[model samples]
Target: MRLLVVEDDRTLAGLLHKALTQEHHVVDVAHDGREGRELARSGVHDAVILDVMLPSMDGVEIAHQLRAEGIVTPILMLTARDGLPDRLRGFDAGVDDYLSKPFAFEELLARLRAITRRGAPVEDECLVVGNLVLDRRAHEVTRAGRPIDLSLKEYALLEYLMRNPGQALSRTLILERVWEYSFDSFANVVDATIRRLRKAVDEGYEQPLIQTVRGVGYKIKAQ
Candidate 1:
């Protein structure tokens, strides 16, 4: 998965980038709030790891701006202050998860997984679509107890579909929610991703859960 790391602290930012990259994720680093906001608004990232203290603008303000513009990318806020009021402020500014400094990298990873998993339906640390199961914590997917490997984008697309269940999601809605500001991109990446997701999730299933709505979009339902 691609992730944006917004931090003013060079040392911490470097460490985070290295750690996240080691996990096979693409890490984009920004040293200040303005650059972070610009990259985040580009809508190319799966998630954002943001620091509360930044130059030009703070993380809270950046998050508020993103939310105001209808950007729903899951934000994980990093703060040195562990006060209740500070955490409350971060939540109010639209942070999905919070981690204080001097934290374990394992804890950070756990929180990231938890928040991203919660963003979709199918809880219990895994996503369930009929007999298919996706273990978010383990990053594993199985159908009829058989393991299936998927790319990060495919996993994200499938999770979104499963979370919404029977809701008919428009292409525009999917692009906005999953791809950030996808209007400028000329490629039909969303369609391609959906096709790949369907191949993995429904190729051998008795009844396909994903349904196309002609010219509209797609929906996932049991029946």
Candidate 2:
């Protein structure tokens, strides 16, 4: 998954980026709340790990702004403030989850997975299109109950496609949602990633779930 980690603490931010990258997640780091808010508002990240005490805007305000703009990307607020009032404020600001400082890395991972899982209404914790199942929480994909491993970019692309199952998603839409402002129409990164995603998601399946709509774009649906 693509994640945004917002922390003013340089060491901790670096640590998180390294750890999450090692876990096969594409992580972008922001050292202050203002920059974090900008990135978050772009609506690219699958999830956000935000620290409350930040330079400039602060995490609570960032959350509030995101919600005000109608952005529903899941945010997990990290804070040293374990006080009930502080936690409550974070929630009121539209944080989906909260984790106090000095927390275990495993716990953070689990919470992130939990937040992303609850974003979808499907009860299985796995998105299904035909016989294919995408376990967002587990970061695993299965076809006919057989496991398929995907790269971080491939996983992000597939998850986006699955979330909007059957909708014709243009390449421009996919680029804006998945890669943020990093690439434009000239970038073939989207095509390459989609090719890889298609291979992993449809290679062995009897019917391909991803379909091209001539000049329009792509859509995922059971054939």
Give candidate 2's TM-score.
0.72
TM-scores for the candidates: 0.60, 0.72
Instruction: Report the Cα lDDT for candidate 1.
Output: 0.81
Q: 90-139, model 2: which lDDT tens digit per residue?
A: 99999999998899999999999899877455664567888888876567
1-223 per-residue lDDT for model 1 (tens digits): 5679999999999999899867866567889899899889976566899999999999999999999999888899999999999999889989998998989999988887777666554444566878878675566779889888888667767766776778888888777656544573623787888888889878977798789988778888753
Where in model 1 is the C-alpha error above 4 Å? 1-48, 54-57, 60-122, 184-187
Clash counts for all predictions: 0, 0
Which consecutive 10 residues in model 1 have the weakest lDDT in total?
A: 178-187
Displacement of residue 5 (Cα, Å) in model 1 is: 4.8
Q: Which candidate is the best by lDDT?
A: 2
Question: Candidate 2, overall lDDT?
Answer: 0.84
